[model samples]
Target: MDAAARARLIRALAGTVIAHADELTGLDQAIGDGDHGLNMKRGFETVLAEADTLAAQPLPAMLAGIGKTLVMRVGGASGPLYGTLFLTLGKTLPEESGMADAAPALEAAVAAVKARGKSDAGQKTMLDVLVPVLEELKAGGEGLPARLAATAHAAAEATVPMRAVRGRASFLGERSVGHMDPGARSSALMVEAVVTWLEEQA
Candidate 1:
């Protein structure tokens, strides 16, 4: 992956968020704060806007702009969590590549997100999807891109059964059992987008 690929991922996520904004909000409305959809939509739009001006910078700089945008614009835990994820990726990523030379940067990002959110897999947070991706990357190393994608998708799917153990959804306790956490859903889609994009490249 390169800058274009990263930008494409953000762009796709933005579009998905917009298209499903109501659904996401509805999902959040059920178990968590009702703002997840709109919040995510706003953050990604900011990312797209910043992407326009970042053509000249390295991919890291471009994504860092997005990280800052989320930190300032998006409200709730997701803002800072995602901000940290992107910022960590930006800080650690190779200058010439994006997710192509991505295993280490992605690992760093998962760690950052976990640290920022104070949650992990089975907690029904973004880390559910993220942790598997990182593990696949670490285990499979550079050749794990496809496996990383698969793991993320599987992890996301797994969240459907697990009750929310952190964040706003946690308040629902047992009621959160059946439904998916909106944040985790969004994270899965984001990773799925990357996987689909990479498969296309192949």
Candidate 2:
């Protein structure tokens, strides 16, 4: 991607998180510490502030830089978990990547997130959305971007019915079932943002 495209992608990612800060916080309030939104917003704001510098780098380096920024700026468990996701993608993806490179890189990233969080799918965590989105990417065919957005939304919604078994929500046990996981919702929003941007480019 060109520097302009990189800048646009960063804006979309950061803007999405910032825009939904209130919604994220609301979700967290139901079963978590209620800071997911603020933390994500803060981290992404920093990312936005550094967009020019980040856009100047190779794609892998840009991603790694964003991950590092998030790890340093975002608060709570989200920092390390989301940081691991991006950092792993940065490590696995080529500087210039194609669709063929994305699935495997994302797979590695998801694995890293799982290891970092000690969680997996069906746990009312971000993994609930990420794993399904990864599967959709692996499936790869027509309308992939739209399919990914749909998959992410559905996966996030699916988390509402699941009892939390990890993270702060785990403390609520069965009480967590009625609420969507904040991390899952935020993850879905980021997926939607990136997918939308990709569709626009196409």
Candidate 3:
């Protein structure tokens, strides 16, 4: 994607996070600390407020800055997990990248998140969404963005049936199975935003 596309994608992701803040919070209220939504909303709001400055920088630089901003502005597990996702990408990706070119960086980011959270796929964490998205991206096909978005949404929904094995929700044991994971939902939201932006580009 180009610089303009990168900025627009980030902004769209932020807006998506804000729009779904209440739902995310409600999900967390059922299984977690109930602060995921507000923390994510606050972090993304900072992204919006700093848009001009962010847009002025190179894409990687801008992403790195936004990651730092999230780490600084948001609290709870989300700030670091999400922040690391972007930070890893910003640091690993080339200055300009297409979906194919970005696969390795995206994979690396996912690995970093898994390591940082000490969790993995099927654990009812953000990995539920991110892993599928990465898999779809790696498995590339026509309309990749739409495919990845669908995978992300499906993975997020799949979390509802999974028993949490990590993080705060794990304490609830089988009780966590019926509730969606806020982090997974938010991760899907970010993927969906990318789909929307990509569609707009077409």
Model 2: what TM-score? 0.99
**Model 3 C-alpha RMSD to native:** 1.2
Tell me model 3's lDDT, rounded to 2 decimals. 0.89
- Largest TM-score belongs to which candidate? 2
lDDT of 3 by residue, 130-192 (tens): 988888889887878778888998999999999999999999999998898999999999989
Please tell me which model should have the higher TM-score, number 1 or number 2. 2
Candidate 1 Cα lDDT to native? 0.78
In terms of TM-score, which candidate is stronger, 1 or 3? 3
- Where in model 1 is the C-alpha error above 4 Å? 1-7, 98-100, 141-146
Query: What local lDDT score does residue 33 receive in model 1, on the 0 to 100 scale?
Result: 81
lDDT by residue (tens digit), candidate 2, 1-202: 7999989999999999999999999999999999999999999999999999999998889999999999999999999999999899899999888889999999999999999999999889999999999999999999899999999999999998899999999999899989999999999999999998898788
Model 3 spans with C-alpha error above 4 angstroms: 1-3
Candidate 2 deviant stretches above 4 angstroms: none
Clashing residue pairs for model 1:
1-100
